[model samples]
Target: MSDNKSNLTEYLTPLIPLAPVLSVKSLSFVTSKTKKQQSILGCSNKLQLTSGRAAIAIALEHAGIAKNDEVLVPAYHCESMISPVHWRNATPVFYKININTSINVDNIILNITPKTKAIIVTHYFGFLQELTSIRAVCNEHNIILIEDCAHAFFGSLNNQVVGSIGDYAIASSMKFFPCYDGGILASSTRPLGNVNLKKPTLIFQIKAFFNIIERAIYYKRFGIAGKGINALLKVKEWLWNNIKSVSGEHYTCNSPASSDGGYGLEEDWIHKSTSVASNLIIKQSNTKLIIEKRVENYQKIHEALSGLTTAHPLFTKIENGFVPLVFPLYVDAPEQSFDVLKKQGIPIWRFGEYLDKQITEAFCPNSTALSAHVFQFPCHQELTNQELNWMIITIKKTIK
Candidate 1:
């Protein structure tokens, strides 16, 4: 019996997801009349692209930013955020972020110069960046303000939704919602221009649908059934690889590359529109319920970890109407904790790992520390109380 208990504890559990993908049953109820969909469409001249990077590329092009122009970007960011600037042949100037992950406006102003054309501010981990001062500075300098709301699709500040605040804003719907692929670009002052985007190939659409189905199965099945599903997935991969090798076709089975810098922009996919199935998934989702549940889960974890000495949550309190994308914890040894949680099969992520190596500690010390130390846990609406408790207890045991 003791051996059985040891084995069970060692057995890797599947990841607890941050969002719930759409199930087939939910598809029947999809409609365009939901308040969320209406609000998203009404924001401005909107363009839906294959991914957030694509949206940024389009926004830069439409704004008349040309090669050799400088665009200020927060140092603490994913490579995808920086990749679009390269795609446009624009230079990226890194700015420091404060302890709360908001941009230091002083650093931004210092970085701006005659060649500066735009500034991109990110609402890190869904906490709103205080944008009024930054906007004023941008206005003073005649620099375009672009809000990176990739982590803040539904978040609002002072009653204005994230995408509405900047001269141009972009978001990754896949982060906040269950859609397989989506990117949104919105502007208050100008049209998005006539971007000729072709529909994604049928093969791409089918692959996306299957990916969502696989996530659904992972969420629903357990024990032998779950193991069986995983085994089947492996076999499918093997078969697909063989098919690709024999067919002598370069057809890839996954969604388009999201952040290849500027390498593959000539491909038909760079101008691809969001999938119809993705649109349907978002149209049918309950925006209010999603926000409330995410807040509840985040607060529950925050309260549980408040007094712990081994690790500290980045945000201790949840503000009204703020929906968190993840619960970020700053720990003493991030690499060790990440390995422990990963071994236990907890779905965890660290965006710091994906930061471009070109960004040095000298350029942005605070962002460097955050990149190395902050670990993000799943706090999306999909997690139940029991799962949240497991994650909290696991961290308490491992971090010390």
Candidate 2:
């Protein structure tokens, strides 16, 4: 048994994740000589594509969604998330996000009409919940279920990962581990339909390449360039909104290439993963070890601030080793708390604005209340303990 175990360990060692693709430190270069080694070869029983968005679009298209089908979607998602269903000529039935947990789809199920064909579930901000009830409902109704694991990877309930439980699973690789752009669509019930992988046009490819380079440069010099770009974009937006007549060239400026920072048209699939993303994955380095550290810091902060302030951990108990995408703090007086925090240089946010509409009426009251009053603080992998301590001190000083 010992010899067999050793052999198994040796064989599986290379397959384990090495490191996070995006890091605060200079771990690898985009033009590194060893970058190309990470490209996947041949297809699997599952479909893997150049980008997560494209993968979801293709999966939905293959699922027989016609022009009149109604696809239920989480209202809290970005506009870009609904493109797949729209591309299939389907109507987007907006559903409310459960605020308290950011996991349940109570709002969506209640609003389901006869036209509803599928439900897209986002494991919001990495919080996993008991989905047995939701799955049971879908099974009973015969509605196709698609798990959107864009913010969640490897999260499980009752020994089943989110991706494995649904009729189909859509995962955005870039969101989790820093791959440039890629998605996985896997199905057990229905064989994924045959389809050709279309490469973005060459011009789009070249433009996207440059945009990636530009972003890298911007992020690397975030102290200056990041701020400058943000300020300039803000000013541009202000001008466009206030001076509509002068914005007559809006159509020209809003063309695809200009809007997307010169990315190529959406027809090519070069299948080239970014060097930065690949190197981060292959080196199996300790860059993401920072997330573990952040989790520890969050525990200390939560314990210290739990009763003194309204902020709380949404999960029953934050799962061990899971990185937090945001630390949500519910305040008694959101405006007051926000003002106090802002005066102290602590940036806080309320994120569920998209769920305030008609369809959102179906969302949980607890979620809605929390969403309206909660302020999210940065808990990204790179945050330092000292920074967290300072933030806590500032919050206490200002709130009281």
Candidate 3:
């Protein structure tokens, strides 16, 4: 809930990044400040929050989910998704997903009860799931659909952008944009009541902006700019030590604040709005190149990894409306390669890795299999040619 200053070594970034890392040059693409961007920010009936889980919590509240109500959540999910249901005091009935991780509509139908009031469907890896059947089923049962678009903030299906199709939808802007903190709750079908929020304190706001620059330098992102930041950081360190020696003050966080999204829902920041800096970045930045570059990078991985014996892509084709958040790959043996790939500094993540204990292999076979095998690699707009090539080569080498 505090600053998302993950220690320099978290999987968030390998020696290379697994997601978008901002640099000074990253802002150059923000061509217009005043023009209304055609992205999700342009949508009406949307509320911004500090993180995606916060939006999920709000979606639960606004969907009229009360205590002990059952909300259909995928068996394969991070704690972020599960925690919000707990926060609402509602039971999360873990539904089985199809092999590709789409909702198993029959499972949903089987699981529904009078207490079941809603269903949450994720647009996994930015590939939109075919939701027409799910929508109809929800309508027939009168269950609200909470579309989770954390991996998908852009692109469209049936001529309507994502996050607008469901009765309620939420997105994680930090994944798509260069900013540190942002999430959106949007609905086209229902008018969203305004979520009153107090601005973050000036110091926190400053840190929110600075954390972007610091994270880039932490990952050694820009060629020369990163090095320059490293040099200045050395000077600052020296000055700080000298000052500490003189003032007899040395601060230490035995446990620095961690866990921004996945650990659990933080009620403290749920009411807080996005910082001013991130809101500006979200609104000003153009996404045309961002989308095109993401698609291009995803295409490269699909073409290169299609032939791998040890690993294969989860989605074979980047469908017309698909915009990827990461290259979702299923390696044959995570026990053999997961740690090795991490040690090799491959920018990879497996959202389904630390799934809830209640979700057993016997309970949900596809979720169990997908949880162990499916790994996500960076396919963000900020990926460099070298990083892309290196990750591809490393993954191929490590797995095979």
Candidate 4:
């Protein structure tokens, strides 16, 4: 990264997250759901883990991917998606995506070799896409199809759900629900068989639950409880600092790398089960309301931006039988507008901003252009009208 861009990133980070955090308002939304939530996990064979990348690792392991095997991954991807391939000591061959971010089947076919063991298809931004053609190619080549649904937990196409069409599917529950962390590995065509998982300790479980509420409070999303959480946090910080000072122990936020947390996958936490709190929240989350609110927010943002000259919606309209994770808009001269929007504290992100070193602009023009120009804005269920407008209005002012 250029020194200027690196400095900007360091100084201007998003105060809020891309995912929904637990708040009193979100809790109320959860209780309103009466139906047992429906999702891709209704499949017969499924396992819950600490994070989506862990599910990916388990998927690769179960598929018998090992050292020297080659996996086909999209050129446009987050590190988490690519890390699992490396974790298995496998090489990932990059494939291109369409300008719309859909998989380029031609690239997939051209890159295939006898060493190709698996191909991962991501349902980018919760857009439900039919996998019939891709599945046909996978079958012809005897390649395992791994569906990456990190951005989408619910959706269907042609009577098949998002995760069911592939040999294995992975979902990041925390992104869709107001939970701390959770992920699921599932398959409809094959049995996951049996694998042991170590339960998280009681202390970790307790903190995981409270941390969600704490995050919400920090964002002032907890209404009247926000002040109380802040006050208690101040007192806690004071006591912690004084105690550490007296003991001559330096304070640090550093923790050992675990598969249960952080960006890259850690082998140690691969077998760790999702925290009880995350599972409970996932179970009780208002699936119906989530779909409803997300669709509403997505359409609203699209409508607001439809008239803008500087940017345009990636998908002219939301697809049927699906909900959106975020409102993706393509802005012209992102070099000019992207940082301006970020400096204004917009909860926006470019998924493939920093891809594998092997990936280049010449190698994947669409991915490179996207990483530079496409910005994703949150459209989660928890966003209020005022909050949504703040984002939309700020985007308009800056993008102009």
lDDT of each: 0.73, 0.53, 0.79, 0.80
lDDT of 2 by residue, 1-400 (tens): 0001112322322111111223434243433343322111112345655544555666677777779998887666543456677777898887655555554456667878888888787766556556677788788777878777655543455655557667777665444443444556666566765665554445444444444434544334244556666676568668756776775544321213212212222433323232333323424423334345446665666676676644555554567534444566667767666655554556453545334254333444654576566666655444445666777788776666
Candidate 3 accuracy as lDDT: 0.79
Q: Residue 282 CA error for candidate 1 (Å)?
A: 1.1
Q: Output the lDDT of residue 62, model 2.
A: 71
Per-model TM against the reference:
0.85, 0.63, 0.88, 0.89
Model 2 lDDT-worst window of ten: 1-10
Each prediction's RMSD over C-alphas, in Å, is 6.2, 12.9, 3.8, 3.3
* Model 4 whole-model lDDT (C-alpha atoms): 0.80
User: Cα lDDT for residue 236, model 1?
Assistant: 87
Off by over 4 Å in 1: 1-14, 23-34, 37-42, 221-254, 259-268
What's the lDDT of the predicted structure labeled candidate 2?
0.53
Model 3 lDDT at residue 86: 93
In model 4, where do residues sit more than 4 Å from their true spots?
1-17, 29-38, 229-262
C-alpha RMSD in Å of predicted model 4 compared with the true structure: 3.3
The sequence of per-residue lDDT tens digits that candidate 1 reaches over residues 331-383 is: 87776776677688776656655566767788777888888888788877666
Instruction: Report model 4's TM-score to 2 decimal places.
Output: 0.89
The candidates, ranked best first by TM-score, are 4, 3, 1, 2
lDDT of 3 by residue, 54-144 (tens): 8888888888888989999999887788888999999999899988877888988999999999899999889887789999999999999
Per-residue lDDT of 1-400 in model 4, one digit per residue for the tens? 0102244534454555567877654545455343334467777799988778888999999999999999999998887888889999999999999988899998899999999999999998888767999999999999999999888898777677779888999998877887776889999988876767888777567667667767788677877868887888779769877999899987453211332234667777677788888898777776787888889999999999989888899888887777788888998878888667778778775777777787788898898888878889999988878888999999998888
